[model samples]
Target chain A: MFFRLTFSSIRHYAFRFSLAVLGLAISVASLVYFLSFGEGARRLIRRSVEDFNLQLLVLPPAQSLTVQPLLPRSLADSIRSLGVGKVYSILRLPYTAGFPPRAMGVVFGRDFSSSLRFISRYEVVRGRDLRDSTVREAVVGEALAKALGWDVGDTLTVGTGRYIVVGVVKAGSPMVDNAVIVPLNLLMEDMGTDRLLAVAVAPPPGKTEEVLSLLKREFPGYTIQTSEELVKLAKSFVALGDAIRFGLSSIALFVTAVLLFAIMAITVQERRWEFAVLRALGATRWFIFRLILAQALTVSFVGWLFGASLGWGLAEVTSRVMVEKFGLDLVEVSPSILILALLVSLGVGLVGSLFPALSAVRMDVREGLGR
Target chain B: MSRLVAESLRKTYGRKAKTVAVDGFSYTFEPGRSYAIVGPSGSGKTTLLYLLSGIEVPDSGKVLYGDTDLTAMGEDARSRFRARYFSFVFQQFHLIPYLNAYENVSVGLYLKTGKTDHGRAVSLLRSLGIEDPNRKPYEYSGGEQQRIAIARALITEPRVIFADEPTGNLDSKNSEMIFRILTGLASEGRTVIIATHDLALAEMCDVVLRLRDGKLVGS
Candidate 1:
């Protein structure tokens, strides 16, 4: 009978009920979408960083850009003899613009053959690495190719120098698709490398923190970023996503709550007479209140459907856009975030019904009937 | 057996103004009897019924169900008492607009007894001369709806039935039909109390009380 009463009331004023449902859906779906995209991007970024063995790297400082230090020339020479297995030299430069073979983007250079196991996030989809003897050979990512249109056997220009495209690898990471790699010296000096850039160190298993401490002690001016920190930087409130996600979700939670509250208050007023009648007909004050609450739940549940869809849509759009912009491989959905959104919707419904329930409870059966 | 009782009932609205809606009134009703309280608008007849049924608390009085003092009881206890021992037939019916006649009649039984014996609910409807128990209250005639309300009042086997203007919305024939149902409950050892201006039904009740202000006038 509680359910029946709720259902009947909804049927009696369907247009109002639908309005309430639509309002709730927008809030719930949008919230879920926002949270999911952030989560998805987190995973994709982590996977990309891990493929290149960046997950466990220990940095010099919490704010360092040197993801791998053992890959640098002078640093490699010392680290190779410091009881560490192999120290492959790697360099990375991050500015607004770089050479054209990398085409005005972040630049990375390292010994590809010697450090392939440690620093090779790329897959060599088409050609070989720049060999020790090859003076005019380099490799470009698919995205960089799409941007500048160069393939195998094509001549590429970088930092006022030219090189033949010797190899290609399809690395699905955002960093790889937007990067250009060359032999360490060729990237910095021989290929007219304008910048020395930061270096990555792939220490043997369990020795990462030890070698990282040594590097930090040796070079006090430079910063070292671990794989976990790098991944966190790429996905978190680092720079880009904070402004958008935080701004939208905050606004959504606020505006949606107000709208929901208003709708419930109006509904309570319209049904005041009915509530009085129920109370007159042997329904307790609590019974009348529960009826109103049940009504709100039904309406809010409908609203959550739309809200969840909108949320999922936002995530899908976010992941796709990020992938296109920076080659991020974020997932389409986030289950945890979806659950949170539904729970929020349920809460909204319960909270919104409070005043309405009170209104029902406070009615005077005799005053309402006017007898 | 006493059906419903009220003693020294006093109800005041707000503090300073303290409009006494029902003041120092007392009444006792017997089982197997029908009675009506007749008065003009603003009289306290309906208020008295609400108090006796345990729906509202009297400020300084006691409502008794057999020996239970309802006014001193908790709100939940009052609600349970009403659900088990009484049925209300309001002037406006209070039938859930979404539910059909059968559903409405079965509600009292469902809540108090937690049973959905549709056969019993339907059989009660049939006895009331309901044309189609499956139809919503709005679809039935005024009299058929009153009949449905009577069925609802009876379905729970309540010891007392309170009707506020039981025939207010019905024609003469429909009014008489409702009157017959109330009398039938009375004859079956149930108390049937109605508040109304209809003299014909008022004449049929065992005792007819009158209310001038909040106090009762002589029968």
Candidate 2:
């Protein structure tokens, strides 16, 4: 019965089936559009946290923290005592070239092993890693290297004084790969700040929160955080992100749903007598219902397939466009997002088809046939 | 047991001073026989078929298909009963215009597994004297469309087939052709009940039921 009903529906080729699937696909795409950035950020943060090997990141409350470079400082040693694999202070300061200043640069300083955690993604494309801090030494990002034009053994004025070129590294992330690395004390001397910005700690696997909870309990004045917390903070940013994406995609999906409803309503209306005839021919109300359901499912599935792939592609294009136009990082959209979108579209199609399918059932086949 | 039985069946449209369409009707239609109800407009033949076929519930009394009271069933049960027990043809030919002849046949076979062979559909249509196999109802002549409708009814292999004024839309020449096909079904032992006023159809049937003012008066 499902077989013949399918054939009958296909024979009708009402186009709504394809349209529905397409609508669903687009909805899926809308979902992708809405969630892709968050997905990418989520991925990148996990990578960074893994690279940092820091079990903890302690800082001030997010609202009070204002330096775009360094998060707020915390008591570094208390966190280190709490079964941490290791602990280190991280510092970032704004540096300019001349005695007066020629160009601006962000100078990040830490213990070489510790700094490597935050910048773990980088690979030395040329030169070497940062050496001991008594002598001014620096490791530049590949792009920063290109900009400064100093190779191995060349001296470049880093903050107030000259530093020897050490190793250049490439972290995969564009954000990190573009940064300059220097030894911890020089960064403090360069910034003239005694307070370290934040402390990063590494602990045993899966004990991240257990450690942060302890640090938060031990040191109440300084805001204590971790990579997981940072990821959580970044993830919280997605509430706003999701709201914006949902707002945009809902408009498109709402239109798709309404359009699907209207088209199906019209098609059902047009087929009144056909339904009537089916009823007259001994089709029970259930049979009539199945017919409409079959039609709706057929249309919605086709629409979803088209809409998901097309919408995903559209999302990809839109992300690319944003990248070129504004240099904004739109995250990688997931297949699940597309699948989710498709599911939403199907839901919309199912909801939209309800009234018309009932209408088909209610029509009098005898009167319909009389006409 | 007869294929169809109506025992004192009655149907009235309104509540106060209601309009009665079928009143106090009792009839028994047997298998392997053809019966036609003859009546003028508003004489209740079509309504009576509607009641017996379980498309409409009778206001009073029972329509029994082998002891199952159709009027006792709910919408879903009646519909299921209808799907398995009978097929219908109608005056307007009521063929799905969007579907071709073969596709039209498939509609009648809904939800029935192995009812997929279009070979039987094509053969049946051809047997009914339809020459063009691929045309939809609108493209076919009224006679051909009616033939397709008949073929649709047969495709389900229902126990009984009901048709409301099966040839009412056709010319007498085409009408005679439809009669032959219907009579042939009866000869094959499938009960056929056709609601009509065409005496030519009535004279050929195994029984003729005469309806007047919503009552079965003469037979």
Misplaced by over 4 Å in model 2 are: A1-26, A61-85, A93-107, A112-118, A134-137, A142-167, A203-218, A318-329, A367-371, B1-3, B15-17, B111-114
lDDT of 1: 0.72
Report how closely model 1 matches the true complex, as a DockQ value.
Answer: 0.54
Off by over 4 Å in 1: A55-62, A65-73, A93-107, A112-116, A120-122, A127-135, A142-150, A229-244, A317-332, A369-371
Candidate 2 has an interface RMSD (Å) of 2.8
lDDT by residue (A1-371, candidate 2, tens digit) is: 55555556655755655666566666666677667776766666666665555556667555334464354333555555566556777776664444553334466775654432555556788876765767687777665555455577777665566778787766655344445687777766665666776776766677767777777777677666655566777777766777788788888778877877787788788777777777666666766777776777667777666766676677678766654432334567676676666677667777788888888877876665653
On residues A1-371, what C-alpha lDDT tens digit does candidate 1 reach at each position? 67777888888879877877887777777677666656766765665666575533333344444433333345545545565555455566542333432243445665653553544566788878666634757777776665556688988665655778887766766667766766666666644434333345666678778877876676665566677666666765533673486468757666766776787788777667666655555567888788888888888877887878877777777777665554544555667777777777878888878876787677766666544
In candidate 1, what are the lDDT values of residues B23-90, reduced to their tens digit? 88888889999888888877777777888787779988888878889998887677777778888887
Q: Model 2, residue A196: what's the lDDT? A: 71
Error of 1 at A146 (Å): 5.6
Evaluated at residue B162, the lDDT of candidate 2 is 87
